[model samples]
Target: MTATTLDAVTPAGAAARRPVSGTVHSWDLSTGVDGPGSRFVTFLSGCPLQCLYCQNPDTLRMRNGRRVAADEIVAEAAKYRRFIRAAGGGATISGGEPLLQPVFAGELFHRFKHELGYHTALDTSGYLGARATDALLRDVDLVLLDIKSWDRDTYRKVTGRSLEPTLDFARRLADLGKEVWVRFVLVPGLTDDPANIERVAAFAASLGNVSRVDVLPFHKLGEAKWAALGMDFALRDTPSPTPREVAEAREIFASQGLTAV
Candidate 1:
């Protein structure tokens, strides 16, 4: 993520009750992995990063989504309150990068908390974490932070962006005692290096607020999307890490005392 990822909003403003609007790519009532049990997940549109493995390349453009109002989303989420609450689940504002529509996302999350009385989570890449202010985070019950890599050069190679911004965001979240679920992708011959994984584990361990770590195995699931978008599928030659590799990476996080899932 880059500063441009959050080009749609700035930090430091108090969240308002008005009907703020944003672009949405899609949504689903998902379970298990998003956050907690089951969730009413809203996928916002636009992202600045060009991660070669992006599964939803269709959602990467800022101008390609339908504009939606926060109240509409809140109303939709409210309808699912009974089922979601019973499942120990909540609402998640995910995206190509939700921070891109900061005001809209903040308002939706605030409503989810104060109005619906449900858990609110932000599934983010933390590239735009700098744009998430205290007021916004205040309403967020959890943050599923995807820390792609720990090495600076390796990070740039992986996501085509700098690493400092993400770390800065993670530290800020830590300072606030926010519950964080760290997600790292394990790609063979690229991000599967043990030293790199260890570094990530060490940093997450230092945070003292990370509740869990998810070591996701790399996959070519997005290959067809890349072809459809006329983007080169660079990972055609890059293999997904084997099951053993996934286990080893999880072990590394566990060794650092992180709860690996």
Candidate 2:
């Protein structure tokens, strides 16, 4: 988000000088939910933020991830290449902040694009977007960018990081005309605020590159995970968005002329 360093990386740079390894939490073969078509989604490991509502808190630490070479991951994904292609999906590299391991994630994405000849998508918070090399972004066909909140105070409280970085990255993507799908989680008493959503939608509209918006209703499904990790679940009493609430949120995005699903 700070000006990009992506241009500084070369395919034969450090990425190729050694075995670019990424810490992986898991991977899944899923329908077009993450991007277009059926995809081979790799959940890379490590993150800088400690979001209060993380569903996979287990993946928050670098030590918890299994180290792996980028090539090895591509080989594993290659097995399902045909299936993924036939289903119109390709590959998606998600995180625990995929940007945390920029070189590793970039290598995997680069290989998928050059060797596998498949579309690639990156799921990131953009908190570490400055870590991403331009080469990495070029390989990405789409981005599932999560802009958690628009209010500065609320944003800091929600993600424990500055909101400007995400906006900077979003602006950079818009400048590149990259296709984006924005995901917003609806926590009724929190992110579901009308003004907050309106501001988010307005900012997204200004971007002009966003094609889809997903209004995800928050749930307590991660309560058990929090307990297992011995972390207090502050939103335990917060309820999920009602149908009416979700509709209203979606309507806000739609007012911007963007498709809100």
Candidate 3:
């Protein structure tokens, strides 16, 4: 992708423009889905995971997104800073996996906090390298971390990856005292097993920084996206998690003393 140019007058009043850097699939400066507060959401590009139920399948291809400067994103987010502040909310950087583009995510959050005074959150899969972790967490206020599954074999089958790194990332986040909300998609046959739910609850309970757990009921919302891209939908025959399933999963977490939202 071609680098996008971002023009900005320097604080010294000099005429200058710099190339803002980062791969961004798209950005919705304001979205209500991310957290308690209204948010200015930046959907970054690229992800390593290939979850069968991924809703944004198009985001999995790193090359498909546009390259934009971090400054450009900050500019757009700045426009809504007041609205974010008024609503007790802030900016949330989500992605194909925001951690995949550490430089951009870090710079965006840094600018948001230091430059614009907006609260910052990262919605991520936490599959980033150690260096990326250091960068991405620098100014982040909250994290919406997706814990794919508890059982290693089941995790591998669902995401084409192991669960160790994701768990390690969560532990590190907790060590840093970062506020996190652990999100799990309750896939009927995959994630709703009694044993798996209990395991997940135990894992989450061990994390001090995990403030909440969100049991997102799996749906066919992404089937069309998969069809549009001509990729076979892996969970096509699978039905959505029933209300009772969600409640059971919620109870599993609640048993561990963690609120499931």
Candidate 4:
């Protein structure tokens, strides 16, 4: 999508200011899942990985999204400020992989935090964490980092990407003292290996900055999306983790001294 320039006044005379724009799939309001309370969540389009259980296959490509400027998104968020504030909530910029358009993500967070005086969170996989500049991170109050797997081989199999980058990003965030909430999807037979779960738990606990760990049970909510997109639903037969299995996984993280939910 092409960038649009906005008119601005300079000390010398009228000037042009180009705000960062990005391909946004859509946005929504949600509570208890996205962040602290209620949140105006913007879902940007485009991603590098092809996970087997991706729920939003329709958001996998930039072409499927509408081009929107950071300002436009910020304006829309302002409309929800009152309600969100009343709920002790804020704003979140989620993806298909937000860091894929780091500049646009940064601009949105900067405005959400500074301009709107709201708490801001970035929902990302950390695969493109290197793209997130310190300036961009400065405005982010929280990061919801998805760590798919602790096993290198399993990670690549799940995301079609190496696990090293995510690990590196986690360490970087730790060093930066950034508050992070780790999200782990519990897929039976795939990610439920107790050993793998232990490794993840150990790593997250060591981070020191990890405030919460969300053990998300796997589901087929996206199977229909895959069918609609004409893509094979590889995990169609894979059942959701049983309640017992989910409890066991959460216990693993809790054993690590992390507040797992």
- Judging by lDDT against the true structure, name the best candidate: 4
Q: For model 3, how does the per-residue alpha-carbon lDDT over 100-150 read when each residue is reduced to its tens digit?
A: 666567778888888999888889877764535465576888888898888
Q: Residue by residue across 1-261, what tens digits does model 2's lDDT show? A: 111332233443454575567678888888857899989999877788777778877777766678777778889999997888788889999978898878778888888888888899999988888877788899899999998889888888878899898999999999999999999888877788899999999999999999999888888888898899788888888888899999999999999898999
Question: Which segments of model 1 are wrong by more than 4 Å?
Answer: 1-18
Query: Higher-TM-score candidate among 3 and 4?
Result: 4
- Cα-based lDDT at residue 14, candidate 4: 17
Higher-ranked by TM-score: 1 or 4: 4
Worst 10-residue lDDT window, candidate 1: 3-12
lDDT of 4 by residue, 177-209 (tens): 999999999999899999999999999999999
RMSD of 4: 3.7
Checking candidate 4 for backbone clashes, the offending pairs are: none
Weakest 10 consecutive residues of candidate 2 by summed lDDT: 1-10
Per-structure clash totals for the candidates:
0, 3, 3, 0
Cα-based lDDT at residue 70, candidate 1: 72
Each model's TM-score? 0.93, 0.93, 0.90, 0.94
- Look at candidate 4 and tell me the lDDT of residue 150: 92
For TM-score, candidate 2 versus 3, the one ahead is 2
